[model samples]
Target: MTLYKIDEVASECNLTKRTIRYYEEIGLLSPQRSEGNTRLYTREDIERLKKIISARDVLGFSLQELHRYIEVVEMLTGQRERYRSITDLEERRRQLEEIDDTLGKQLDMMESKMRTIQSFKEEAEQLRQQVREGMERLGRQSVERAEAEH
Candidate 1:
């Protein structure tokens, strides 16, 4: 049962001490303390912290979403360990599938919005050209009026 201090774990994971502390404050990691009240992190804790960072920063999971997954898994198992129940895993899989569907819908919406914006830009350019032509015609008419009056 080898344990690492906060600094050692942070250096090993290429993360800053402040980031690790913040994760702890956010209920992500929970390291134990020695008899002298020094924080001692286990290998399991390190693995969980690494997973959280990877899921959030690398995989683009929001903190709230990742926390919800972790909480459900933990609740099903009642352990600070990986989940084991078949039913719970199935439920998680279903939830993930729903998330995928929702993301697909959002992507379709974004594409539609992009098309609309592009159309608006084209219309604006055409309107600008028309305004320029109108101004030039008005200038020519004004010159003709001034010459006739002279």
Candidate 2:
């Protein structure tokens, strides 16, 4: 149940204080506030920030995409909560089946996105290697020309 101040959160998450505040503004975070109006971050906030960083920096998902994903997550969470209130065994089983199907599709969609991002990374690496080879060749040619001139 430990809480962190904004500074602590920024340091722990490797983000600027402004960036953390901006995330709150954009609905990516919802830190509680002290009586003095200072932002108070819980352990859940820290974990969520890590996820956000990975989603943005590693997966290359834009803020809008993150927002949309959050919406889908919240919707799914609500659906799961509804199962707790269901009393009839048959109805619960039906709801559970629906949840399983939806979860599978969501996982598939995430896998597809990861594959696409990996493709882009591979392409960039190949381009980088080609550029490096070209630069090395040019440097060698320049040196050869200089020796010949001498």
Worst 10 residues of 1 by lDDT: 77-86
Q: How many collisions per candidate?
A: 0, 0
Candidate 2 stretches greater than 4 Å from native: 81-87, 118-150
RMSD per model, one decimal: 9.8, 4.6
Candidate 2 global CA lDDT score = 0.86
Instruction: Write candidate 1's Cα lDDT for 81-131 as tens digits.
Output: 232333487776765565566555545544655677689989999999999
Model 2 per-residue lDDT tens digits across residues 52-139: 8987786567898777666556667777998889999999998898788768756775787889988999999999999999999999
Q: Among these predicted structures, which one has the highest TM-score?
A: 2
lDDT of 1 at 112: 59
Which residue pairs in candidate 2 have backbone atoms (N, alpha carbon, C) closer than 3 angstroms, thus clashing? Answer: none
